[model samples]
Target: MPEFTRRDIARGVALLGTMATLGDGSPLFAEALDAKTKAALALVNPELLSIARKEAAWRNGPPLTKNYLNIRKQIDGSVAPPLPDIPFAKHSIPVGKGIPDVIIYVINAGGTKRPAILHTHGGGFVLGSARSEIRPKQEMAKALDCTIVTVDYALAPEATYRVSVEQNYAALKWLYDHAATLGVDRKRIAVMGESAGGGHAALLAIVARDRGEVPVMFQCLIYPMLDDRTGSTRMPPPGIGVIGWDVPANVFGWRSFLGQQPGTATVPVTAVPARTKSLAGLPPAFIGVGSIDLFVDEDITYAKRLIDDAVATELHIVPGAFHGFDGAGADTSIAKQFTHAKMNALRRAFGEQSV
Candidate 1:
């Protein structure tokens, strides 16, 4: 665990204070959203809104000020508590060439050969870890009676573009290769991720198709950060950037992951799922995003492409929600609906009769 200084603690306290002031379902703040979006924002989750407010404050400054390490520590601290006390086993898989071994969190699912999910944590690609964001995975494991493996893929600046993708791919392959030992059903494996993890999950599906080794039955992308062009070459819809992962933070995350300025000519298609010309032959997908989220346009666009390619896809756009709302309002009615929809999609993809 990383050590937090007084300043870090104060910043976190200030964030809580700011969130407290926002109150639950503030009508004043709801006006920033569009009419269609406002309906969903009627009962805004204060906890999620707080995260948006913090991001908004960060957006007001130089994006680089939000260091990956610091943000990771703070987010981990916030989520570490309230996480379900689910039993999870950790394992390390070797991915040669001196790169760090991939760390996987295998949640307890009793002693059965059940469907498995290879989860990729969000954080724009530079932040997040399996340990920091284990709640959702825990919930999914218990709800669906499945084993969940969340990957701690290498972060960016240090591990650029292909490294994280290949590492996650390797994790998928390892999970498949050792299915019996891990108590996983090889044919029922799926790739799931949130935010940057969603982008990685999308990439992993592409990689799986290309490699023709491990088969991914489905992909559950929760408001994926798919396009590098987003927040750079592409400007989001009007008023959408008012809260939750504004452009400045988006630019910084992309720059850090790409190891160069984002939206540049040199970025490889392999690194950006949006840059990929084809969405054919990929697995079925479930994509959920909020209308106010910066990634809404890109997520909708990607879902359209998948549909056009004749893939089975489900796209859920929450009216007034923002990025990370599902986590922020996990206990709220809307958040429960969001989660239920996602779990239902996964259950169907896994060929289960009931959710």
Candidate 2:
């Protein structure tokens, strides 16, 4: 078997690449005497910390942006250790008149027809594909014992804002219409997304609710990038948390998604989910965000509002974590913690005991 790596060591190409550049100001700035934790972690897996430092410096330069974008594409194309015997189907679902068609990664879960999760991949809505989301969706299938449909939604810069949301809504409607065919319990269907995907999940819930179309059972917003218009939180992120994500990278991601300009207040909820004022009557939600993410404050506030509105809402604040920390790698304690939390949330939602 291939050696398992640390969570932070995997899937953190972009995140750690950016962190190592801060030099003396870096949160993980290394010291000579640090032992035990570092040594133990290093013993389990080696070269990650050093590799991250090199990768981080390169990430700050212009060439790094090109390399980073290229890496981002690779990430989309690769989902860990491709699935077998899972029996899946893929189909194109029409979204809008001008928007690119949405694709769904369909996996058949043999059992009594049950709930399904419409997963959206993160990458600031500019990168990441259904393929990139395969692993997590597969995990969800094994855990939730339900069909998991992942959307190959439109990306920005090429597709631009609103197009993705429009496509996601169309995909949800398509899924609802064909629920019986897919052996899915339409009423138990939930929308779960990570980062940009999470933002889309929130948007999908509202859009569906507003259109009086399909009912969204739950919204799992994991480290969501809500509003492209809003960057640099009004309430400052605590200084001591994970610094893998800094303001510059967050700004870069938003700009990449917006396609026009980064800080334009003109951006709509179709682009930035947080821009939508009426989040009431969406659905029960499980909101998970890291303390270091740019969207932490917004996500936390959104969760509180959902609760205040009497929606059954669960918010988890992962300590010393950055945005998109879920895919860090399976080798770290944090990764296991995230997995357990994810499994528990899905289990509870699906009426199963924690696995």
Candidate 3:
């Protein structure tokens, strides 16, 4: 992807801010929007409006069930920023007898017994690869002086929730078992991911807790797609899901991953983190989401439930932000602060002094 200089981003934000309607001349929201929702919509950070417009166009595309392959290709074809100079390696570890070996990429800053994170990439569970995240993971490793193991779990419609979740668990097991060899401190292992990946991380934490094989010290969920019911049975307010990652795409993604319609009683509680019975015994968590994002309500409820269960939880609701705003508006001040907060949280989780 082409790099956007500060001037370029500022200019685009300014140009997009003056427009009342989308590029296709459609109203940004429905005419029936409530007074309170209208007020909230007006506060949407102008820097993220450009991304929201693009996401709206994407939402209008062909149904994911019919066009998911092409969409996956588009996501995989996008150019990533140059990889930072760091030690990177790939390995395939056997998950089980019949299950395929899980692939993982390890990005390390090269230190003895350093902190580590097992990260799952976000694509709503059907699109994305660990390779696509190497650059950012390398930068993160360099910045945090840690090692990051990113999993290439199988996608949905082809591979369901059980497959992907088991793949992630296998990766986590491998990370903990080989901690000494990888120069990682096993006691400091954390699980982290964004969007669907965040949901996967949450599930993995539950599995780790129940199985008692590996201990996850922390979980950093970034606007995690935790509840399948968000866009299905339980709809958000009028202005919430209208922007990036709307109801249709969310329902499709969940259905693909769950192998059934979301929000139905048949959906497994283990598959959807929000439906999990208890948050007790789970690791400390940092949950971050945008005020208008589709998953905002579910994420907040999960954090509150965690607190109720006596878990250490830090919840951040970024005002005027939308799903994936950090990536879309990385140069914006809000995005920078959000990233800083996440890193600091991870730092503290790893028992390192916060910057």
**Cα error, candidate 3, residue 71 (Å):** 1.8
lDDT of 3 by residue, 1-355 (tens): 1233333332222111111234453323332444544454565878776555444433433555566565454445553654747888999999894778889998883579999999998877776778878888898988999999999999987989989999999999999999989999999999999989999999999999999999899999998989999989998886785665667778888998999999999999989999999989999999999998888999999999999999999999998887777876777889999999999999999988888
Candidate 2: give its CA RMSD in angstroms: 6.2
lDDT of 2 by residue, 88-126 (tens): 788998776777787888876446677888877776665
Winner on lDDT (1 vs 2): 1
Candidate 3, residue 113: how far the Cα is off, in Å: 0.6
* Winning candidate number (lDDT): 3
In the range 51-80, model 1's lDDT, one tens digit per residue, is 444433423222333344555555555554
At residue 258, what lDDT does model 2 achieve? 69
Give the poorly placed runs of model 2, Cα more than 4 Å off: 1-10, 13-59, 63-68, 229-242
Model 3 / residue 215 / CA error / Å: 1.0
Q: Look at candidate 1 and tell me the lDDT of residue 129.
A: 76
User: Residue 177 in candidate 3 has what lDDT?
Assistant: 91
TM-score (C-alpha, index-matched) for candidate 3:
0.88
- Span of 10 residues, lowest total lDDT, candidate 2: 39-48
